[model samples]
Target: MRGIRSLNHLPKRCYAAARRSEALTVPLAGIKPSSATPLPPQNVQVSKLPNGLVVASLENYSPTASVGVFVRAGSRHETVENQGVSHVLRLAANLTSKGASAFKLCRGMEALGGSLSVTSSRETMVYTADCLRDNLGTLLEHLVNVTAAQEFRPWEVSDLTPRVKIDKALAQQCPQIGVIEKLHEAAYKNALSNSLYCPDYMVDHVSSDMLQSFVKDNFTTGRMALVGLGVDHSVLRQVAEGLLSERSGAGAPVAKALYRGGELRVQNNEALVHALIASEGGVTGSAEANAFTVLQRVLGAGPHVKRGSNITSKLSQGIAKATAQPFDATAFNASYSDSGLFGVYTISQADSAGEVIKAAIAQVSGVAEGTVSEADITRAKNQVKADYLMSLESSETLLEEIGAQVLATAAYQLPDSVLQAIDAVTQDDVVKAAKKFVDGKKTMASSGHLTNTPFVDEV
Candidate 1:
């Protein structure tokens, strides 16, 4: 009887093993498919609230959601008396708010697997929150508190001094950062001249009152945009109207950035020299700016491949011919709402810095003299279009692009329109852009051994 029972169990086990050996692609023996329909794709929707808050969102049907509040209270808005307030404000994002304690904000986000962060530039500040689609509401509550209801306790604000110093110290480690900061300082008379990092004198001196005043002046609905990705437009609009409407009217007058070209040099003992020479180029969203974008690519905008030689870059090729010494060169283009900067950035051995700088400038001059070919123009335009499209593929970048456009123009521009603008750039346009840079007032900033670096007027 025992042997018979053993044989029966063996057969059952063999049958179960055989069933499990079926191909994964094959349907299971007893599962039914659901009849639910998938959600349709939606385009970006934008609306402006009566209070002047711009609300934009897209329902991409993604499992994760990202929302951002873009405010026009960047470092550019800092007054002479409150320089570096924006830097301190960025670090104070997680401080105790009117609605949530600092600890609660941290623990709440951790519980929901979400994150909140703040980033500021010369023109805008962005507060972004990310979480699963199901937990968006909870995340938004924290986002609102952080962006609008900040308490900015004195103790918490004081505690940020060490972090501020750390930020400056880290920036000091990179010559590129110091050069860029110095360039901005020399490029503008006001507004855009403010440094992103806290100044040494203002690191521990940014008072709570200063932060509050800056917020009151720049966080108004007139200067804010609420943007979202993988979320409903109606939901975002409701939040904009109901929660972020307290600062309804235009909060303060904005001063336009005045460009006054100049130069600043930092002498150091390093053997390598980093230099940037620029001239006024084009304003953001203009046809001239598109031309400059193409011109930048034609000259060279860094290497496309990771750790690959920039053999195709005109700057690199020209500079290589100028000297056998190891050097790096790339065209730099930055467009802002009111003004722009276009130029070349080069790093070379101290003895060859002057030659490298001159060669890079000659490359631009060659483009201005129409030495470039139609093929080069075509390639550059393609690069510009590809970069623009690829940047929007990431959700974070997409949200930022949307927020920037909406905040700047109170509207959103589709990627197709942007590509069309790039496509409209002609070879003549590229040459003209190069000519403008060659003739416009120049601003330069350089660091490292000054043994061979040319002065701005000399270059």
Candidate 2:
């Protein structure tokens, strides 16, 4: 996490300009510029290959190089029969480099002191690597090979498939996981929320052939995006072209959108009380969506951990020794291509969890009711904006943001534009967004000692 904090030493001119204007009536706390305000990304070059792949490049003066492959395939693309296939696909992707006999992609990556990994979100799968700039030649060759020359061995798949399945099964045993499953099932009903990741049954059902078929249909050059940073464009392009030149996709079509609605509750035998609530929030493009984004940051972001705050700290401390735990809450605003979800989760003493949920509900309800003051809006805005700026410290983060933003939406804008949009969000906007969320259809799911919790019955 050695992130943008290092940028504190950058020339004082940049820092000085970021200082708040003295003449403004707005408190310095409200209007102080964050790192995101001053730095605009240098120009990004975008081009398309004849085969339909997109290549986007940005140069960072940072010494490390980062590369990523983003594909438009995730669990949303899974069918009931193939529910966990995407997860399997992500796992299988790693084994390709491990199996590469001819070029030994993994060995080459390691030689460059680099690491490669693949991760998935609700809509896309991302394969990424970071290395020293000098090793770009060998690293690119190996990177392309892993995606292009994937050779799934019978033994490897058999071993890996079971291991992942077992791990997922074990994870589900946790009360937190059960609560999440219940929440999604409640909020999204049978739709994409329920399908964020494949269930264990689907994982067990996935065969090696199904995985290969998924790869064939989804890992298309036509649907792929290549993102690179801190490396020469020509060298990266040459490497990408050489490996991908002859490769042609079977051209799988994009998946359909699914939005089933309902509520789910999992009653578990445990001492901890857990409750969750999720509701409809707008997506990235809507004005309401922007308002919701700022509101979430204002309400949830903290000087503590990513999900830490005085509320969580106080709740945990109060219930630390009680039969019911003090309340621990996590509020999330998840965005997707077509829709989004806003959620609040809590864990508290079996008896007090209900009160905790009430407090949280009351808190958000006030936001909905337009009770948040200018000071609340200002602090939340500043903290949210500051967090965004602090996150841009590394080339990898910037690289990931660019590639994911493109895959999520084909259009890309500077971080400054996003910051400006956030800055422009007014108190009225956040309250309006909150009202929409509370009044709209939402879902709730939970597990572990929640049978008697009030949120379970809230509606």
Q: Which candidate is the best by TM-score?
A: 1
- Model 1 deviation from the true structure expressed as Cα RMSD, one decimal place: 7.9
Clashes of each: 0, 12
Q: Judged by lDDT against the true structure, how good is candidate 2?
A: 0.68
Per-model TM-score versus the true fold = 0.92, 0.81
- Candidate 1 local lDDT, 1-459, one digit each (tens): 644666545666566667766755566669876669987878889899889999999999999999999999888899999999999999999999999999999999999999888999988999999999999999889999998898889999999999999999999999999998899999999988999999888878999999999998999999999999988888898789888888788878888989999999999999989999999989999999999999999998988999987889999988888786547999988898899999999998888889999999999999999999999999999999999999999998999999999999989888889999999999999999999999999999999999888999998
Candidate 1, pairs of clashing residues: none
Best by lDDT: 1
Write one digit per residue (lDDT tens) for candidate 2, span 1-459: 666666757898786678666654345665766546554556766666777777787876557888898887777666666777777777776575443653356567778999888888667888888888887776776777677667676666766766676657776767676666555555553335545555756655677777767777777777777888876667656655667654566466654344454666666677877777767777756777778877776556332656544453222333343335435665667776777777676776665666676666666776788877888777777776777787777666777778877655554678798788878999989988888767777667666676567643464
Q: After superposition, how far is residue 4 of candidate 1 from its true place, in Å?
A: 50
The TM-score of candidate 1 is: 0.92
Model 2 C-alpha RMSD to native = 8.3
Instruction: Please identify model 2 stretches exceeding 4 Å from their true place.
Output: 1-42, 97-99, 173-178, 189-191, 194-198, 239-242, 245-251, 302-309, 312-326, 455-459
